[model samples]
Target: MSDLKKEAESLHKAATALRKVSHHTIKPLHEFKAESDDLGALGKLGSLLGATEDIREGMHTLAKLTKQLDEEWQAEAKLMGDVSDAFDLLDILLAAAAQAKKG
Candidate 1:
């Protein structure tokens, strides 16, 4: 894989780590203390943060996967191009050898 793709994959993994940490480990200040008339707001805010982190992480993973797939496709295309060039060279060489033998 190309370096860009590999780097993207690593970044994606880091984002996933962030999400897991946020979900299982990160606690809100509210989880520790004072309830207000807007305690529901704090709960909502916490949920929003978690959801955003999860979605951001998912997006990163998708981007990396797409890049890796593209790189793989490009590598295959290059291999096929090389094979075609080799075939053309062989054809010319064989044609020239046959013509010389016609003497």
Candidate 2:
């Protein structure tokens, strides 16, 4: 196989690995909560409901903020990658020019 093909395959594997890690690291951007341990014989029903609702709202807000921050970071990363690619393309162009001059 050609070197470019090998490099592409390696890049694909690396990207897949990174994508899996990225997916796992983000955890599902959904509201999650700790179940009510206090809902047992320890508290009034109304108080328990109120507490549960409070926890739900708090988790919802937290998840929303977490998603926004994740999106912002992802956007910044994409921009940086674009800049890097632009620089790499310059090297490619220069190499092509040198080859043309040799020909």
Number of the top lDDT candidate = 2
Model 2 residue 12 distance off true place after TM-score fit, in angstroms: 12
* Cα TM-score per model: 0.48, 0.49
Residue-pair clashes per candidate, as listed?
0, 0
- Most TM-score-accurate candidate: 2
Q: Which regions of candidate 1 are displaced past 4 Å?
A: 1-49
After TM-score superposition, what is the CA distance of residue 82 in candidate 2 from its true location, in Å? 0.7
lDDT tens string, model 2, 1-103? 4344445455445444544544654645531322222333335764756775565567667766766776665665555555545555655676788899999
Predicted structure 2: lDDT: 0.55
lDDT of 1 by residue, 1-103 (tens): 4343444455445444433443442244234322322235446665776764555455556555655665565565555555545555666676778889996
- Local lDDT at 80 for model 1: 50
- Alpha-carbon lDDT, every model: 0.51, 0.55
Report lDDT (Cα) of residue 73, candidate 1. Answer: 53
